[model samples]
Target: MQPIFRVQSNLLYQRLEDALQQGLELRLVTQGDRFCGVPIALDEEFIEILYLHVSEDEDSPEEDPYARTVWVIRIAEILAVAYQQSWSRDKLAQLLPTDAATSEVEES
Candidate 1:
């Protein structure tokens, strides 16, 4: 059966998109960092719910764009999100670059 099309109540997407649109860099801790567009498009499942896509960008001392791309991830693996705090300069420094704002987060 086709999933119902609905507006995502995901405050995450709203915030991120707003930040991005306003040219503010958002620090997202995800698996993959790149996507065809948004990790999930409109009318897709998980609408209104903030679903995390694993970013491909693994922060290394070396530059790796492939590591930073974003992909849909399982809910089980996420330990946390940037809910209460932003990434540290150290954390931000470690992130690989996919766009103007995103940085690398090396695997722990």
Candidate 2:
């Protein structure tokens, strides 16, 4: 039997992503407004959000490199994501973009 992580090839795939992208089965998340759900394709690898992608209107004056988009967040940073399903009105809500956090220590 195929692992549950795998996304089935069917109508769900097309509806999930507008451009037709697929990955391991992961939960979709929405921002403060829970009405709309965003299907997030997660990989074990650490993905980076290039500043170029974000719109100028969204950028804050603080200019944080990581604060612009949704990604794996530490408890101190925001609130719930990936695992934290409990609803918080202000906490930035999003699906777990990655399976694991970025490695701080690199062994050569």
lDDT of 1 by residue, 51-83 (tens): 344545466434433333344433223223342
Question: Per-residue alpha-carbon lDDT of model 2 for 29-106, expressed as tens digits?
Answer: 334421112334422222211112333565454364333234431112222223223435323223333322222122
Structural RMSD, model 2? 17.5
Q: In angstroms, how far off is 90's CA in candidate 2?
A: 40
Q: Give candidates' CA RMSD values in order.
A: 14.0, 17.5
Candidate 1's error at 105, in angstroms?
A: 38
Q: What would you estimate as the lDDT of candidate 2?
A: 0.30
List pairs with backbone clashes in candidate 2. 5-25
